[model samples]
Target chain A: MSENHINISTNQPFNYCLHLADNSLIMGHRLSEWTGHGPMLEQDIAISNIALDLIGQSRNFYQYAAQLKGEGTTEDSLAYLREANEFKNILLVELPNGDWAKTILKLFFFSTYQYYLYQKLINSSDKQLSAIAEKSLKEVTYHLRWSSEWVIRLGDGTEESNKRIKNALDELWAYTGEMFLPSTYETEYAENNIGVDVSSIKIDWDKKVNEIFEEATLPSPNGEGLGVRSFGKEGNHTQHLQAILKDMQYLQRAYPGCEW
Target chain B: MILEKNISLKKIWQILEQITDPEIPVISIIDLGIVRDVHVDENNVEVFITPTYSGCPAMDMISMNIRMALLQNGFTNVKITQQLSPAWTTDWMTEEGKEKLKVYGIAPPVGKSIDQKYLEELKVECPQCHSKNTKLLSQFGSTACKALYQCQDCKEPFDYFKCH
Candidate 1:
């Protein structure tokens, strides 16, 4: 096979796996940032659980990626060794979790995309990919429902809460477009029915989001400039990912081969 | 001839179902989807198991329970093997287990039973009132695989079985 074809075959799955793994790892790390900073004790525990779930999902995807590479690369190595530009996650996941409203907004948007993505991935041609998708789709659905409800409550509640949630939506709106951008790797895998088509997800995402926004009495953001965010698939990332990597990879990097 | 083997397997299944989940006392490990296989060969019995999570603290307890159950049933040579591939998922939860959860006032998991994505999208019905108008009180419940939810109609907080 030509080098291009070989790259297309092998790296397609690898890149798709990385995107899935990175989404989980980055989102998990963001949730972990609220370890002791949540508004209440119960909410603190809740965020921690969300963090753990994401980390678990990341581990599953990373393990599968390692198997595909067939180089005995551990999940830790893939997670800790890759540079920010090498990561293939969407920018929305990498964005900083500014406040509770911002975090909720991010979760609502990401979970909606993930719910649809995994729904299609469950029917993937690859058995392992299908299994992972079959498993993760259940978790992401709960996450979407949880966050969507929060979006409604915060957006339609008190005047102050409503204003804060709206501000969060506006601030994070720029990053939403990256979630729908189909990468070269995704295109290749989608041809074989081994990966999901991002474009197809936008319709369901918009409908669900608009419904929630309408229920919350929040105005749907209207702007032609909304989808102009930098492309994360092309190695462009927000500054937040760099800071996130520093803390996330610290333990593995500090003491090599350290085991719990 | 074959009938005897079938009878023994059914008996083994019954014994296994009696083994309760260490973390959630109300449910059995068999219903929780941990026991994968059970086979008998002459005087030897083999039991295959998978953990809910890779490093779940309750695995030891589950193993001990299985051993004790078999020994008490006059099967002394029981071997338990752990299968890590095709990782265990919430989808393995039996229909009976799901119903038990609802009756126990915890919202059963819905959607791609194994995927976490479904946990985020599907509206968890109120365990107390069976209303879809329930809201999540917190993502974390008493256990790792559960979320706390409150019913808007009945105003009762219940646990939701979060997909792992």
Candidate 2:
């Protein structure tokens, strides 16, 4: 829970936690773009709640990461004060919210990954991370279910819906490779049971994605390394992330330490 | 700082009972079964809470309120630890809390915990008309802890504090 058990490497857990936080933060912002714009009124509210959940998850990680940093850092400072290049979130999360089909499919992909990741993380020797993962796993379960249901509905429904989901899968497939690309901390932390082995989740991720896509009659879009792997984990990102930060970090940049 | 072995957990409970959930406003933290543990240490009081939802944003406010309440009530040092094991379920919400939710126009959670496959098929009684004919509009609702439902009988939409 503190800086005590992490004998592997001090920066690993902090960096790991920061990456998780950044992913959720950016995903929350992406999901928020759906506010008041969902296909139906019920869906509008549903997406907002999912966004809130992601934002809240990010806050927990950020708060913990801030504590780990221990030099008077706080959640707001970590979330809002950081420059675009400094964030370590994978590229999959920061892409633009394209269409309803795109958003739902993207969400399905991420939620599936999170579901498997948290399933393993819940058993982490790092108690705080374990607790956070356990708690997050429950929420992600619902998210996976909701988004997967939509993917199925859209994929099997009609010609137009099917076409959109197929296109989304192709557009988003390349970005997901970065999720499985292992970090250096995994070898040490995985040995200590304090962190997840990202590679371990890859099989589950693929199986889950394949099954869902199979059920929906959509082919697996992860072509044979057709897309270039962007090192978004190390802060390289598309032009889209800067635009997101322009809006997300605006108030914080304009008014430092301002609270509502 | 003198160790207060005389401090009672019941007294701490009384203090906690005064703190309402920031989001619901209708339910106290105790009513939602969030106050999982209370330890009156020598110089400090430690409270363990489990969040109703993993990402419920109100947890911070609730923790702050708890600290403030205890500090104001003479406990100088208060510690709040969030626990996530055995994940918090709607089943943890007290029966009294469930009643209050219905009175507040939100449907009380029906099951002890979610059987995810069956969640969609479960019939929830409408808070407004108490109709079992209500249909689920969305599994996610106003908050992560709720689901949106529509009562066919009364033709009204309500928030269901979803089970788990």
Question: Pick by lDDT: which candidate is best?
Answer: 2
Q: Compose the digit string of candidate 2's lDDT tens values, residues B9-118.
A: 66888999999998888989999998899988776789999887756878889999999999888888888998776678787889999999899999888876645653
Residues B73-135, model 1: lDDT tens digits = 988999998654466777888889988878888788776644235534568898887889988
Residue A42 error for model 1, in Å?
A: 3.1
Task: State the weakest 10-residue window (summed lDDT) of model 2 chain B.
Answer: B1-10
**Whole-model lDDT, model 1:** 0.79
DockQ class, candidate 1: acceptable
Report how far residue A58 has shifted in candidate 1, in Å.
Answer: 1.2
Q: What is the C-alpha lDDT of each candidate?
A: 0.79, 0.83
TM-score of chain B of each: 0.87, 0.92
Q: For residues A64-166, could you state the per-residue lDDT of candidate 1 as single tens digits?
A: 8887777668788889977787787888888888889999989999899888998898788887778777656656665777788889999889998899998
